[model samples]
Target: MMRSPANKIPADGEPELPGVPHVHVASVVSALATLDAEKAGLDALAQAMAGPLGAAFDVAVATIHNSHGRVIVTGMGKSGHVARKIAATLASTGTPAHYVHPAEASHGDLGMITSDDVIVALSWSGETVELRDIVEYSRRFDVPLIAFTSNPESALASSASVVLNLPVAQEACPLGLAPTTSTVMQLALGDALAVALLQSRGFTALDFRQLHPGGKLGASLKFVRDVMRKGDAVPVVASGTNMGGALVEMSAKGLGCVGVVDGAGALVGIVTDGDLRRHMAHDLTTRTVDDIMTPAPRTVRPDQLASEALNILNSRKITALLVVDGTVPVGALHIHDLLLTGLA
Candidate 1:
């Protein structure tokens, strides 16, 4: 096996030492070093699974989604932590997943396992004693057992209905005793599985929104309707109104824009800060809304995606969009709203 530099140092009187270990810089270097090994390990795993695991992974995916069954992921030690994250990602995506500790599964938790559920076991060595009981139970009941392990010849692989061999190149640990590259590759592969299955099932951002209801993700999927100014809060003026009246409405609303409605109360045009600048040459006292307002300016549906609306605003070089239902004005959504929601 080839090895890379253990540490980088500058030539000095004694020896310019490497970035201090366990510090921020060293931590980054260690993470990158392990990432390089993980990439190589994944490449090898891809080659090994080209024929053997391609179909097996498909079966595991199909078992969970196509059959109205859940994927029960389990592991011990470091593998268990990775399994928990994998389960969390899978559940947040389109796949229904949950993690079960191997020891717990052997107890009354075994009842949680059903023929409809697929049991996925993760053990780099594939010989965790805590996994024995659940593996036996899965086999006896004929429940699908999908195993991820570096050792295909181990007991875990032998008993699994489908085995995905995770062949890590090497650990990043200098002692080579800690699980480093192995767990990273396993976790990344788990992500790959979730993304692939998500594509297969046509999962959308809306589906993701369902799972992530907190934080920035929830904010990303928020619609324009969620934060738009509605009812009289929307700044508007009649087409017969002078630019001074329109400016008053726009100034009071503090949006730097106003929607001009016709006598029928339908949106006719819009005026913006840009219009104010371009039409400053004209007298505002006598000019009607039409003389300066941009007619039928880009209007968005109140129900449009905030991300999509942000794109439109950015692409058009505009700061605000009129929310109109057909010809009737409903509300106004602005770039600032998207900024407030973190989508801008």
Candidate 2:
């Protein structure tokens, strides 16, 4: 920790902190220091607020789980940003949540809220004029309300069903008038509530997959069939077929390989580009597909995860795998498909 210079007095006004060093190594160390400080502050705040925050969280989870509606978070200014992030986190983590700016809550947004919903209001001063209507509306409509405010006795806190006192010490800002520390404390408490409820509900990665079924995260959740090429797209030929016919089919499939199937069309053996190279000296035009096909093809089930398929492909150094249903090749998935879907 750097000590305050004796010449740097409060009466001398705000003292400027040193600029981060220009070199990459020095900049990394300074950035790490800031990260460490933020992490410590968040941990400390979480500990300091455990009792009240836990109680409030329990109340919120019980209210939402038992009720037929959602959770509405309302705040103003910097607290509003934290409230929005909290709402997003809660919703993504299995709890239904939404943020309603207090000012907007008065402009017909209150109508969106139902009695079944619980309102979590955040206000550092606990006396924002903009929040009065929604606060009063919650009271009048009998909707359960939980308030977060620095003042336990403020109008907003006093109007709620339960009040979580925010006892942040001082802002990181030298002026001590900004919302820095207070916002951090609120954000930490919000995360605690969200995570506690998340763990309590036994939320799973599969559950999260359902909520975010788009983009990279969604691709990571996909099954083998999601990226597999099905039907005629699969490179395959029946056993005992001539190598000339197999090469023709493999070339048509354009996947660099072919699966040799039996009468059931299920995969029995695989022939790859490497196999062709290995048999280059031999006249494949005279050999049967079974004579060249490597028996017992590597395969994956349609129900298996694509990530597992990727691991298999990487380990085997194969370009593609046959997706089988009880030895029947329903689809084929290439490594390029995984890369296209951002799962590679």
* TM-scores for all predictions: 0.86, 0.82
Give the CA lDDT, 0 to 100, for residue 169 in model 2: 62
Stretches of model 2 off by over 4 angstroms after superposition: 1-33, 49-52, 166-169, 199-207
Judged by TM-score, which candidate is best?
1
Residues 251-273, candidate 1: write the lDDT tens digits.
Answer: 89888899998889889889999
> For model 1, how big is the CA root-mean-square deviation?
5.4
**1-344, model 2: which lDDT tens digit per residue?**
56455333333333334673232344365556555655666776667566666676677667656667888998998999999999999999998999998888888889989998989999988998899999899989999888878888899988988788766566665476767767888888888778877888899887988998888888888999788998779887888989899889989999988998899677889888988888886577778888787888889999898889999999988888888899888889999999999988
Instruction: Identify the leading candidate in terms of lDDT.
Output: 1
Whole-model Cα lDDT of every candidate shown, in order: 0.83, 0.83
